[model samples]
Structure formats: C-alpha cells, structure tokens
Target: MTVRAVRRTSLVEQAVTELRRLVEGGEWPVGSRLPGEVELSRLLGVGRSTSREAVRALIAAGQLHSRQGLGTFVASIAPVTDFDRQLRRAELAHIYEVRVALEVEAGRLAALRRTRADISALRDALAAREQARGAAELVDVDLEFHRAVVTAAHNPVLTDLFATFLDAVRDASTEMVADQGPSPEDHKHDAHAALVQAIEDSDPQAAMAATRHNVEHTLAQLRPERP
Candidate 1:
C-alpha cells in the first residue's frame, strides 16, 4: 500500500478538535469550568490568540458558554444547534404536541415488544405515581412512567429523541399539577392504570388509545377553550 500525504491543520483548528475531544470524552462535563486562556495556551502549546480563537469557536457552536466574570464552562457536549435551540424555546403546548406523536408510537411499539422487565418497570413507575403526595413528586413519577413506556419499545434512536423533550415535558407536568390541584380529574390515575393494563396485555390499539387519552386530556385541561 502506498503512503498518502497527511493534510496539515492550523493550530486553532487542532486546538478546537482537542478541546472538543476533552468535552465529548467527559473530561470536561457540562457546567464544569474550562481552564483560562493562559493556562489553555500553555497546555495546548499554542499561542494565547489561537486558544482564544478555539474557545470562541466552541462558544459560538454552543459547546461552551462564557460568563462575564465566571470564566468559560462546558455548556453541552452535544452542541446546541439552531434547530435544537428553537425546540428548547418552543411553547409547552407545541412541545406536548410533539410529545404526543412520539409517545403514541412508543406506546404501540411497547405493547408489541415489551419484555417482562419492561412491564415490571412500568408497574413500579405507576405505583410510584400513585404514591406521590406532592406536585413535584407527582410530575416526576408521571414522567418516569412515560419514560418507562418509551424505553420498553427498545428503539435507541427513538429513546434519545424522546429524552431531548423530557425537561419540557416535566415542566408541563408540573404546571398541570399546580394549576389543576392534583384532583382525580387532573392526575387521571384511572386512565394511567388502564394504560398499564393495556401494555401488560400486549394490546397495541388499547395502548395507543390510552396514550392518546392521557395526552389529549392534559391538552384539554391546559387549553379548555380550544376548538
């Protein structure tokens, strides 16, 4: 085999690549502060300007964020693209619309493919939801129940995409509990029980219906005047 000539990268580009590696490898986790420009320049054996350029590039890419006096910190290993930022800023109702789409499919697939362990996890989550006494706890437990359902579907890509909306979903759940006062009409434990039973029995149509009812009930409560 003939040896090919290796292409050379600029110092700033190499620094960017190295910094990205450290962040992605968990050497620098989110919210962890990165070294100052002087120290980074020394460590990376580059000029301070090069280090600054690399850091600025990462900040623009959303991998790092700089505070006025607090220094630079890792924002996310997975850079927040424009599309992701838009999703993060979306209204709760719009977020839930996407959630309903994801979960309806997740429920259907879970009913068809869930293992005994998945069923057990779902049961545990629902039991925890029943026992939750406070709004915060109830919201958490409810999300856990839904998360278990998605996980049971055994699709990694779907699971990851669903996870990205979890914070928004949790916020919406908390708002629902706070506004509706956690009554039977608000929490809808009976509907949740029906969903668990449907999943346990491996009934796809029942599972989808139950999931849709849960989503639509919350949407109706949130937007009662919607036609």
Candidate 2:
C-alpha cells in the first residue's frame, strides 16, 4: 500500500479503537453526547475528514448516532445489548451457519498444521471446561477452547470469521443454557475431548465428525420441543 493509504488506514483504526474504548470502558458512557467534531479531531490528532469517516464507520457499526444539526451522541445506553436483542433469531441462525462454514475449514487446516504448543493449549482449554460446573463458567471455557482450536488452525481468515460472531455466539449460548439446564456441559466436554483427540491424531475426518456432532447436539437442546 502507498504511504497515503497506510496513513489513512492507521488514522481510521486509531479513531475506531479510541472510540470503542470510550464507549465500552464507560468513559463517555452510552447515550451520552461525544465531544464535537472539532474537539474530537484535536483529541485524536486526526483531521476533520478522518474523524468524520471514523464517526460514520462507528455509526454503521451501530455504535454511534449523528444528527444533522444537533450533534453525534453515544446512541444508546447499551448499544451492544440493544443490537443483540434487535438481531432476530433468523439473523443469529445465519451467523451460526457462517460460523460452521469457517470453523469446519479451520478444523481441516488444524489437522494439517497443528503444532505441539497448539495441541497443549487445546488440551488446557478442554480441561478448564471439564472443571467448570456452572452454566456461565462452562460456556466461557467452551468458547475459549474453540477459540484456541481455531487459532491452532493458524488460518487468520477463519479466526476473523469467528471473531465477527463471537459476541452473538456468546449471547445465544448463554440464553440456551437457561432452558437446557447444565447437563449438556458433560456432553460438551466429551465432544470437545473427542475433537481434541481427533486433532491430535491429525484426523480431519474425525475432527469434522466430532465438531458437527457437537453443534447439532447443542442446537437440538436449544430448540423448543415439539408437542
């Protein structure tokens, strides 16, 4: 990339990161108005145009709101919570469908390229899940385990794909636990153990089977029962 391109990208990224920290860290808080364009531009050390672009991007991400004559504000008291609630069940299902596509590919690559350190990390994550007794704790470990496995695959694209849906997945899984009870935690650990073993054996087919099986099982538990 050209110097200008690099500079623009850096400025946008810096602005976004700072803005996210402000909102999420509760510095500005949600629903509060941010500093005006000129003030923000000076604060971020960027020009007005860069700040405007950054603000527009955050608005698109559902993080901020801008009014023509009024001003830009934090939008909502809990934008992430608001977005998660507004994202329909169909949207979440679509997210999971995408996750499956990316994760399956990651599993295949992990079978091909996993290193000793990656294997150890996966094992540790699985152990953490096994030790977790509560729903929230179990879900946390389960996600960390999957994240480690995906990272072990060493496919940045796959990791990015999963990262996009991480929040949605966490929200969905937490809701799922409310109905399914904690019994599934045992099954989850078992499935992950099998998946880890498959990765250790460098068996892509087994890894895929283990992964698909676990996903389907969880989906079944989460879905309402038919009369």
Name the regions of candidate 1 deviating beyond 4 angstroms: 1-90, 224-227
What clash pairs does model 2 have? none
Number of backbone-clashing residue pairs for each candidate, in the order shown: 0, 0
Task: Please report how far candidate 2 places residue 46 from its true position, in Å.
Answer: 40
Superposed model 2: Cα runs more than 4 Å off: 1-89, 183-187, 222-227
lDDT at position 27, candidate 2: 85
- lDDT by residue for model 2 (54-89), tens: 665565455776655467778653444544544534
The lDDT per prediction is 0.80, 0.71
Residue pairs with backbone atoms closer than 3 Å in model 1 (clashes): none
Q: RMSD to the native, candidate 1?
A: 17.3
User: lDDT value for candidate 1?
Assistant: 0.80
* TM-score of predicted structure 2: 0.59
| Residue 91 lDDT in candidate 1 | 53
